[model samples]
Target chain A: MITLKDVNKNYSSEVSIGPVDLEIPRGGITALVGPNGAGKSTLLTMMGRLLGIDQGAIEIAGMDITTTKSKDLAKIVSILKQENHFMTKLTVRQLVGFGRFPHSKGRLTAEDEEIISRYIDFLHLAELESRYLDELSGGQRQRAYVAMVLAQETEYVLLDEPLNNLDISHSVHMMQHLKDAAEQFNRTIIVVLHDINYAARYARYMCAMKNGKVIHMGRTEELMNNQILTDIFETPIEVISTPQGLLACYH
Target chain B: MNSTVALTPKPRTSRAPLYTAKLGLGCLLVLILLALSLLTGAFDIFSGEEGREMFAISRVPRTIALVLAGAAMSMSGLVMQLITQNRFVEPSTTGTTEWAGLGLLTVLFFYPSASILFKMSAAVAFAFIGAMIFFLFLRRISLKSSLIVPIVGIMLGAVVSSVSTFFALQTDMLQSLSVWFAGSFTSIYQGQYEILWIVLGVVIAVFILADRLTLAGLGEEFSTNVGVNYRRMVLIATALIAIATGVVTVVVGSLPFLGLIVPNIVSMFRGDDLRSNLPWVCLGGIAVVTLCDILARIIIAPFEMPVSVILGVLGATVFVGLVVKGGANAR
Candidate 1:
């Protein structure tokens, strides 16, 4: 369980993210969907303890995130941000291997290595495991980063816009991977995504934000209605049922 | 169950233990080089019977100065690069060395006969303040352009160097300033070289904070997330770098590019884990300095060229190599 009590983030005179009071349940995929500058990234970062909260507290899995030591928090929750820009050269396996830093402290044990290899193969990155991150295509690099997060083996995975720079097929594959990780491992996956359709189709729950506040949050089906979607996004988004699941079309 | 079992492959450590071995060997090589440097000198101190006064006074201190200055400057460069997330930055490149030079000039002008310790303290403090100013300027510029960072730093260094030059000329202290600027290890002796121990203190502090420093390199938000105090880390790192530069400048004069070259070379062999690669950087530094010192003594045959000139040529060669390699492998 992750609880936010009166959390607020104020960057400048005009910019403030929250004074939000909310609780996230123990296990499920919660899709944070909103427009640009809607505090989606800021709120996600705060939950991950990546950004400090100015006037409130956050607790993850019965532990106060603020007071918890980072080495321990890293074991419970792992986060991957939107962009991964490292000047040094690293192969996919090498990059993913760093996921075990919290556990192994850079000296990887046999078990840690096995887990790293599993995540790599799970992401279909075997062919590119030896390739440097900079040498790979955008989609491949994105997958590599995702694999690294998965290799972290944390119960809670926080990813901010994991689909950015991915192609349509890779995007779908990534969503499926997240869903699988959530279902199989019982991991609590919190993802910030732009595509409402993907959120509607795969997410068990949805949290909608606007100007730093959670305007609407509920089950996927309940939150996919036309009136709620249109009102939240200020656009006419029609909900439709496809063969796979529910989808929201904003065009 | 069978499918999942088949799917999961055994994990293995990507980094080899031999990498550690290589680093250890590198350190051993540096020690050997240092020993050789202690034994050899300008007056053929090794050839005669019992060691003479020149060996005790000139040769030993000069060698110690080279090793300390080289390692400290290179380590400072590594720290600067890690903090700024830019490979091109170094103490010299970022004006820390020039700032120290300016500080030395001020002391010379005001309290010409100040103790070596007093002169070094003044230089270290001024250099730290200058580095902090540059850091603040970086913070104020919201838009981060990597190229502009080094350009701004170099320009700042040039401005400070010019000020020092102008003052030196006015006070007829240009001779002293010019000699210091040339970065010669020749004049270092026992009494003068103890000031460089301050750099060893900085090195110890750096080793203690190595993991946190590595965390800081990942970016500000990430560093904070990982429980590293970013502002504090930057302040500590900047202070260490300035003191390292100041001590080196006082002991052996200014050795340009010693800072930039060693870190890059070490990073090429080892990955960016500062803790692991630090030993490699320090070793590479000692090796380069010892070799350069040997060449500096041997090349002119009884008349020694400054070690900085040797380092300048060597550093330029390595830097050009890196640039060419970077261009060839442009992604």
Candidate 2:
């Protein structure tokens, strides 16, 4: 379990997040969904220890994030931001290989190499393994980045909008991959998502935020409602039930 | 199962032999350039006892200096570029060599009889400060363009060099100062050039920290996420660059573009895998410098030009090319 206790971040007097206290249960896909400037990304990054928490502490599986060694935290949790721009030209396999760095300290043994290849193949990037990142298209490159994070093999994976720029099909495929990764690996996956429908479909639990404060946190079933959606987003949003699943329709 | 990740017939590391062969070829080319540099001097070492002594004292030391300085400077450039995350950054461009020159001048002004080792330490110390100031200062400024980084560095170098020139002029040691930092192998002889070997330690250290350094190029958050001590690696890289720049400045003067051009050219072909590119960067450095030294010898036969002139022209061309072509990606 990951716990945030009275966590606060003051961007300025006018802009701030928390004193938030929350508990994230272990071993399921939890999606943090909110509009822009709602601090969903901020909260996730703070929990990942990518951002500093001003007033409180965050713990992952009983280990304090701020106090634990970064190297040790890397073995337990891996985080990926959306807008990754690499200066170094890396092939898919090589980029995935770097995921083993925390464990192997850059000396990739045969085991590390096997794991790297596994992640590459798992992401269906085998044909593009030898191709440079610059050579890959947007969707393919994003998948490659996801493959790299998966190769980290951390029990807790924090991803901020892994589907930001991807088209519809690629986004669906990415969500499916994350779901499979969560179930098969028995990992705790936390993601920040803008698409409410994607969150409603894939996320077992949904945490909704508004104006830097979490509005609600519970099972997706409980949170999917027209009134609650409108309240959290502060817009006219209707929850529609279709043959497939629940989707938030806002027009 | 977990072991089933490798689904295809192609094994991992399939490119190992090909990588080795390409590296071997690059080394072979550098060796050939070394031979050419060794044979290109004005004096005839093919004659007698006096000629053989001259060969041992001057020609051998000069070529050795070229090899060591070249490899060390280029690798230093690679390290600095990765640390700064700027393609154009190198010792000369970043004011490191200018700071080293200032240190050299300061040592001579205060203690005219200071040993070469003492001079090297002062140069290294000052270089460390200069590189740190540039790096830390660059971090605070949100640069409008990455090209502005090297411009800022060059301006810093110019400012530091003006101070050096002023001090040298005041002491009437300007002529010696110019001659010493002239970036030449002309003054190299057996007893005077051994300090260049200090850079070999730098090369080895870079080899040991190659992965961490490369991760640094991916940016602070990325490397930090992967468990690297990013700030610590930056300090280590700066120290390495300073040591290499300091020692090379003391021994062979300032090879202005050697660091910039060699690594850029190597990266053009080999890409940015520092661990894999270590040998190629080293060899590419040796080849470029040795080839330039050979050209310097023959260009004005019976007299020599400092190798920096050739390097400056070549480096400026590549620098311009990178700035122009790298427009979209410079940010």
Candidate whose lDDT is highest: 2
- Candidate 2 at residue A46, lDDT? 87
In model 2 chain B, the worst 10-residue window by lDDT is B13-22
Those runs of model 2 whose alpha carbons end farther than 4 Å from true positions after fitting are B1-9, B14-19, B327-331
Give candidate 1 regions above 4 Å deviation: A10-19, A54-56, A62-72, A91-94, A101-118, A121-131, A151-153, B1-11, B18-40, B46-53, B142-145, B320-331
What's the true lDDT of residue B259 in model 1? 78
lDDT value, candidate 2, whole model: 0.87
List chain A TM-scores, every candidate, in order.
Answer: 0.97, 0.98
Put down candidate 1 lDDT per residue, A1-251, tens digits, no spaces: 78889999998898897788887786779999987888999999988888789988999998898899877888888888997686755678777887777777666778888898788878888767767787898988998988887888888889999999888888998899899988887899999999998898889989999889888878989988999889888998899888977878877
Model 1: share of true interface contacts reproduced: 0.28
Q: Give one digit per residue, the lDDT tens place, for model 2 in B1-331.
A: 1324445676784122335777778778888888877777778888799889998999899999988898899999999888877789999998999999999999999999999999999999999999999997798877667788899999999999999999999999999789878899999999899988889899999989988998888887788788887889999999999999999998888999888888888788867778888888888888888888888889998999988998898888988888888985544
Query: For model 2, how does the per-residue alpha-carbon lDDT over A17-67 read when each residue is reduced to its tens digit?
Result: 997888888887999988789999889888878888888899999999989
- Per-residue accuracy of model 1 over B1-331 as CA lDDT, tens digit each: 0123333254345653445666767778888888888776657675565556778887778777777777788899999988887777888778888899899889988998898888898889889988998888778775355656777888999999999999999999999998888888788887878778778888888877876776677676656544456778898999899899888887788888887888997777666766666777877887888898888888987798988899889887876776677667654
